[model samples]
Target chain A: MSEGLTFHFNVDGEDFTSAGQASVMMKKNLRQLGLPPEIIRRVSVAMYEGEINMVIHAGGGVADVNVTENYVEIILTDSGPGIKDIEQAMQEGFSTATDSIRSLGFGAGMGLPNMKRYSDYMHIDSEVGKGTTITMRVNIN
Target chain B: MTVKELAETDIFSPVTLPCGGREISGVYIGDLLSWVMGRASSGQAWITIMSNVNILAVASLADTSCIILAEGVTLEQEIIDTAREKEINILKSEKSIYDIAVFLSKII
Candidate 1:
């Protein structure tokens, strides 16, 4: 395969049901490139959780996946009400999702934690009223 | 048992069997999407009361052999169609989640 490849998508926050499309597509693309199964799974789970967070919390967002020789990187950005507390948000059982989101079987306060769990490295940048940017990387080795 | 073999039995109905021949290594029961996504192992059959498009995404991410919709749960035709296209084996049962898990424990 080439040294580097990229995929970009616009996550639709309007329909909660439609979230994760970007992750699925990224999984397929990574599969086609013949990446290791475990790496692909890690990337998929991390990206899926990030996508769900964007849908439930952020109004919507843009996701960019960069596949390089060393690792796969995912960057998700949104112009939604930013996270007020990164520390609390990282806690496994803390969440601000509404009851409706809970009924849908999501908003369980595991999104950020799961993302961190699956990806080898993760970073979050947010402004309370401005926006949020999340970057995660899963190594190929 | 394979997904198709399990579906052939009367206890569960096949909602979609796009990957019927896949072997079901084990069974996982949970309704929380993130919990299931993190815990469910590949080749296992995930049982849940939650039926939605998101379920399909979780199943795919977890690489489960199939999804068992217990307690008579179902998906809309559109979602079922999507499951088929995604090659995600899905089954349904009128039994409760606990009962289905019990049944699977005896067989899987």
Candidate 2:
């Protein structure tokens, strides 16, 4: 078996329904790589949340995943409106999503929190009107 | 109740899926992803109005057997395709999430 694997995807913001495609592929890849179910679940959940946030808030972005024997790393970068209040945005139930977004079944304000909760490490870099970059890692050990 | 019976219920009766008659028990209704993550049980049917791929991810984490997309909402073709590959059953109803949940409660 290969020692590691890397996967990349461009999240298209034009379609919210398509947001989790990359995460699904990553899960499939990790499963083929023979990773544990728990690890794959954690990575998939974390990346799925990031991918959704990218679409719902940032208008889409790029995702890079590095899968290794010990941990999985996911980096998501987007050029959408930067978060104004990172702290508040991180809080569960706090959301700035439009009613339209909410009606589509997202913008519940759980994206960031779920990402943080499922990953072992998470970092957010953003500026208002600029862009946001999130890095999350899940340990397999 | 099994997924088939849930599918047979008036609210969900119209929608048809390719899920091979998997049995489903209980139901979890919520749009709040985090709350559902913490509260939803594995193997239960998740009814939501959300039409995003993250719904599949959340269901996977909670170990849900299938998801019923309420409100006559349509999921993207890609999402449906991936769910099939993931072995996750997905059903869509013409009813709203609320109405579907109510129906699910009475039956299950």
Best by DockQ: 1
Candidate 1 residue lDDT tens string, A1-141: 356798999999998888888999998999999998889889999999999999999878999999999999999999999999999999998989999999999988899999999999999999989999999999997
lDDT of 2 by residue, A90-112 (tens): 99889888997777666777878
How much of the true A–B contact set does each candidate keep?
0.74, 0.36
Q: How does each model score on TM-score?
A: 0.97, 0.77
Cα lDDT for residue A38, candidate 1: 88
DockQ of 2: 0.38
Residue ranges of candidate 2 with Cα displaced over 4 Å: A1-3, B5-14, B21-26, B32-41, B49-63, B69-88, B91-108
Best by lDDT: 1
TM-score of chain B of 2: 0.83
Candidate 2 vs. true structure, TM-score? 0.77
